[model samples]
Target: MTPMLKHFRYLSTSGIPRPFRSIPGPLSLPLIGTLYKYFPVIGNYKFSKLHINGMKKYKQFGPVVKEEIVPGVNIVWLFDPKDIENMFRCEGKYPKRRSHLALEKYRLDRPNVYNTGGLLPTNGPEWWRLRKIFQKGLSSPLAVQQFIPGTDDIVTEFIERLSLIEGQNAIDFLPEISRLFLEMMCLSVFDIRMDSFSDNELYKNSRSTRLLKSALTTNSCILKLDNGPQLWRYFETPLYRKMKKAQKYMEEVAIDLLSLKMSIFKDRDENSSKSLLDVYFSYPELDFKDIIGITCDFLLAGMDTTSYTTSFLLYHLAINPRAQENLHKESVRLLPEWNSPVTKEVLAEAQYAKACLKESHRLRPISVGVGRVLDQTAVFSGYEVPEQTVIVTQNQVSCRLEQYFPRPNDFVPERWLKDTPLYRQGHPFLLLPFGHGARSCIARRLADQNMLILLIKLSRNYKIEWKGGRIDTKSLLINKPDGPILLKFERYQC
Candidate 1:
């Protein structure tokens, strides 16, 4: 037995604490462990079906499922909310999450271009240092409020574009929603309006187009490399090379944008309000490269995640008539008209709109669950989990269980609202779509504002109708819509 296990076994006198080795899971083989089960033609599991596989594992293994995904990487999947609470409680000062190791390698490979593997993959003191610099400006509701006008302008522009395409055949929603989100991120980060909605075919060459392609490529590569065999680590596999190229292109674009923004920011008057880029530039400790890294992280991180979320929200609203009407009522009360400004004040009063978004999050989380590498040892579900064990809380699965949410399969926005009869005060740790504590999503406030605004405006402007098959999710690092999000937007005759 290893020193840590020996110590834990000796120290834990309580009979309730189960041995870490006692965790039940599929039989793991040597070196490859359970990874062979994910191989093509022979493997039973697919990485994209992580959420489904997780649910099956929970039912079979009884919550604490242990699996060695690769040779040296063992993960303990926690399904119970109480165990999840203990997991977070064991998280020390700097919470470290295990993710995107391939991306981390790519960034570290290019010392000249990247200081660290931007925000998503980095952890420990380096991650904390960077997080602290960013938290003040990005994590606050007030900070997001400043960009409301700009964000709403893009929302209005996108809504106009939607109207022109409304009565036509069912529109594919993901690409269009992604473009809209990219436009919003660019405006907030660089103070530049990417005419992504323009009819001009030259939009093919727009920064938004290139950046979105690169971001998608990067996300795809990360999933393949991280989940596949460890061939990339030993040498440059084709997939690894592809990811490197995409990341390099993204890095180049970020650097160029940061430089351009710096020039414009210097020329602006002292009285002018700062954009998100300007705010990052103001930080004395952050150099140009730091700003570029962060800017790229912010843009890439938000695109697919937010777009998928917005797409799902619209899908739910499209199907659930009562919920849609309730949201529409709220939006009309706050917005009054289609072109009404989405100020912070307007968003604050949008109670139903907020609940709808939250409900969507619960139903379809962007990630299967929150991941954490504990710094201290903690017991979970009677198992004495050692420090540094990677624990993935099955947030999506837990939220769907009838115990946690009544009518788990149904779309019920009322559950989130305290005044409603459907509301149940479930575990605090359940339904953490954005995570919790210091390491929660930094873009939480901004993403919420952007999605809520779109939800309200879309509801107010059009009666959403489904136009395609039931939307399922396939994990691409984060859970993304598996099929085309086809929808019809019928303009409301107010």
Candidate 2:
């Protein structure tokens, strides 16, 4: 029998609707279907980058296409901004992300230990409650503004730390940026600096850093399971053991930190200072384990995404000297001092710098797209998508289209300057790396301020020159630099 015949033979009677199947994609094979689309060989690499592969299929199949990660698991991919907006509006009260099966399983396996799955997994009333409990802290504008000075101090110290490198050799900058971002996040979240380099023994290479590492590693392990079959859950795989062990370590550390904070909260004056930690502590009803889980979630999300985005931003500025020079000119014209405490007022004045960052986000979003698991049926691309289906905004793909961006791949921050047609005509939904609506990233404000501050300080002090090969990216959820991000930064003469 032919391959198409064999596939149809095995396909369930009500499998995929004929109309839906006709949307656009490669020929679905006997059993693997469009899985071959993911593995199309290019040079030496094969199926290594999922999002890039998705884009190739998007080009083949029109704006809306269908791809399967595995057999029987069908997903509708969207590239239109209008469809993304519709999908966002259709996300009911408690929007679910395509739920992380491994993370949810980890929570369920330790039900007593994790009574309420934190913000990422839980939905319905449970998610609503969890979100309400922490949103004020995680999404607070005031908290972000308050954090600026402290984070600025860290950014400065990080720049200075970079100078200590002995040679002109290319720096493997990812870990350095990760460490600095973690320190800032620690100070913001726990009101404690999580630094690797410190004068005091207690502060140097802190336990919090270790716990954060474990959390990230465990998350990576869990996501690995997510990409593969479900048989790992039944088997005692080494990977599973390591993840569970890391999870346990994270829980223990969280309990210890909670006790320490609780002890301090009793004697400490309420007006001492405000922080994300203070906000979490205010909700005493929240379980200790869940708080730890949320902390881990925030650390993992907060550290890498912001740092990698900033790194990629610098990569662009490095390659485009004109953008960097323009940004510096803006900063010099707008601010009295580059190293001073960053305020909202300063951020406002650095509009062009902000635009440059926005341009980078448009060109190279950390995540290729964002999704919401629908709660109600919605019509999209002339199809009636069912309830509980995952609707993704291919933001990366949408933002890159020439029809929308007019030379999409090129880095042109000027297009973002006011009075430009591209600036006036672009829809807000065209490039949402963070996401949109009430379900958007809680740390958006924090991420923005962090990037803006880094851009200002880095542009002020150094000339970023790209010493790396082609800038390539890989994503589990948030994309990170796939190759060595080698750059040369010469101190500014001015």
Question: Best candidate per TM-score, number?
Answer: 1
lDDT tens per residue, model 1, 1-494: 99557544544546678878998987788878898878889987788888888888888998788988877777999999988877777787899988888888987887787798888899989999899998777767877788888889889888888867887668887889998888888887788876776666237566677788888888877877875676998999998888888887888888887878888998988787668878877889887667767887876787889999998888888889999999888888888878998888888888899899889999899888988998877777678787888888999889889888889989999998999898888899998999988889988888989988888888898888888889877888788888888888789998
Worst window of 10 by summed lDDT in candidate 1: 6-15
Clash-forming residue pairs, model 2? none
The local lDDT score (0 to 100) that residue 228 gets in candidate 1 is: 64
lDDT of 2 by residue, 1-494 (tens): 98545433433234443455466655556666555545536232133464676677678777777655555656777887777777887787878876456666777777777776566667788877777777787566666788888888898887787687623668877666777777887777777765556644234246655665675566567555655545666875777777777767767765665667667667778677766777887787676766876775676578778878888898899899898998888766655564566677888788888899989998878787887877766556665566677666688878878888888899998888886655646887898878887777788898888889888887877777888888866765567777777778787666
Instruction: List residue ranges in candidate 2 displaced over 4 A.
Output: 1-18, 26-48, 199-219, 420-422
Question: lDDT of model 2 at residue 225?
Answer: 62
Model 2, residue 322: what's the lDDT? 92
The segments of candidate 1 whose C-alpha lies over 4 angstroms from its true place after superposition are: 1-14, 200-206
Instruction: Go through the candidates in order and give each one's C-alpha lDDT.
Output: 0.84, 0.72
Clashes of 2: 0
TM-score of 2: 0.88
